[model samples]
Target: MLVLEGVSRRFGAKSAVEGVELSIERGSFIGVIGRSGAGKSTLLRMINRLIDPTSGRIALDDVDVSALRGKELREWRARCAMIFQQFNLVGRLDVLTNVLMGRLNKVPTHRSLMRLWSDEDIAIALTALEQFDMGSFAAQRADQLSGGQQQRVAIARALVQEPEIILADEPIASLDPRNTKLVMDSLSRINRDYGITVFCNLHSLDLARAYCGRLIGMSQGRVVFDGGPFDLTEDVARQLYGLEAGDVIDMPEEMPAAVVAAQAATPPVLAAH
Candidate 1:
């Protein structure tokens, strides 16, 4: 389980998050939605230790995440992989090499710097790529792939980390509708088949409703709503977005049949405890 108590972050005089309290259960697929500057990114970053909180504590099980430093902090990060809006990958590097970078935390610094990967590690990286249907592109440059394929490579990299939690910040923000569906379906499959806790920051309500079982709505750096997709009525969405009812687009009742079938076919993997 993950717990946050009275968590807040400040930048000079501006407050990014304030007095936030949340408890996230294992294997939950959660979507954090809000307008620009709603503190969604800050919240996810704090959970991943990419940014320090100004006050309060964040704990995973009994471990105080805020207290970790140095090698310990690095190890914690390895367990909590982060996916970014702009798929963070070395454009010039081959896809396989980029995926191998996930092993950096586990490998010796010298080996990582020299790019000396063992056959087993290479095999693992290839398997991760295959999981995302990108195995054929292993030798291609990351920049050579399309935007959606690049994002899949990013997901493959995260999978090789064998993380306990996956934090995706606006992962589909730059993709077209078709690519958005592909990426979201991939995330949903990972969350369901592997039983990995997924905390994603999303801009589209429709995507969130389709993929996430739980939705957390934030406004002005504070959570205004927390509930299942069904509970997010038009009124609640208005409150969350600070918009008129007519402006809020209603989400579909169910995900596309293809996405559901794909998830059903995914095989379960052992996830971190």
Candidate 2:
């Protein structure tokens, strides 16, 4: 489990995150939705100790995280995968090698600098690419692929890390509809197949409603909403994001057949634990 206790991150004169307190259960898929500059990114960064909190604490499985540094911190970071809005793959590197970079934590820095990737690591990365339907592009340079395919390579890279927690910051912000669906589907698959705890910061409500079990809304560096999708009403969204909630969700084509089928078979809302 992940726990945040009165976590506050101050950046110079501003509080990027103010007194954040929440608990994330194992295997839960969560989405953080907010307007730009709402501090969603800062909050997620603190969870992985990417940035230090000016006050309060973060714990994973009851162990304080901010207290760790150096090797210990590196190890923790390896266990928590972070993906950015920009697919951060090496443009010059092929997709396979890009994904293999995820294994850097287990390899010597010298080997990495030398570009010495083992056959097994290469094979694992290829498998991850296959999982995301980007296997055919594995031999292509990351820059050679389209934005959607590049994002898949990024996902493959994260998979190579074998992380238990995946944190994504506006992963689909740069994609078109088809690409967004592709990326979101990959994220959904990992969350379901591996039971990895997926935490994402997104602006789209439709994607969150479709993929996440829990939604967290932040505004002015504070968490104002935490609940199931149904609880994220229009008023709540406007209060948190300052935009009409309906305006935040894009309707793609007709409603997806799979979503329609699921809605027919599944309850409209899953009860909160």
Error at 204, model 1, angstroms: 0.9
Error of 2 at 105 (Å): 1.3
Task: Please give, for residues 119-199, the per-residue lDDT of candidate 2 as tens digits.
Answer: 888889888989999889878889998888889889889988999899998999989999999999999889889989999
Residue pairs in steric clash, candidate 2?
none
| Residues 177-244, model 1: lDDT tens digits | 88988888889889989999999999777677667777888877877677766666666667667664
RMSD of each: 6.2, 4.2
lDDT of every predicted structure (CA atoms): 0.85, 0.83
Instruction: Name the lDDT of candidate 1.
Output: 0.85
lDDT at position 185, candidate 2: 90
Best by lDDT: 1
Highest TM-score against the true fold, candidate? 1
Deviation (Å) of 75 in candidate 1: 0.5
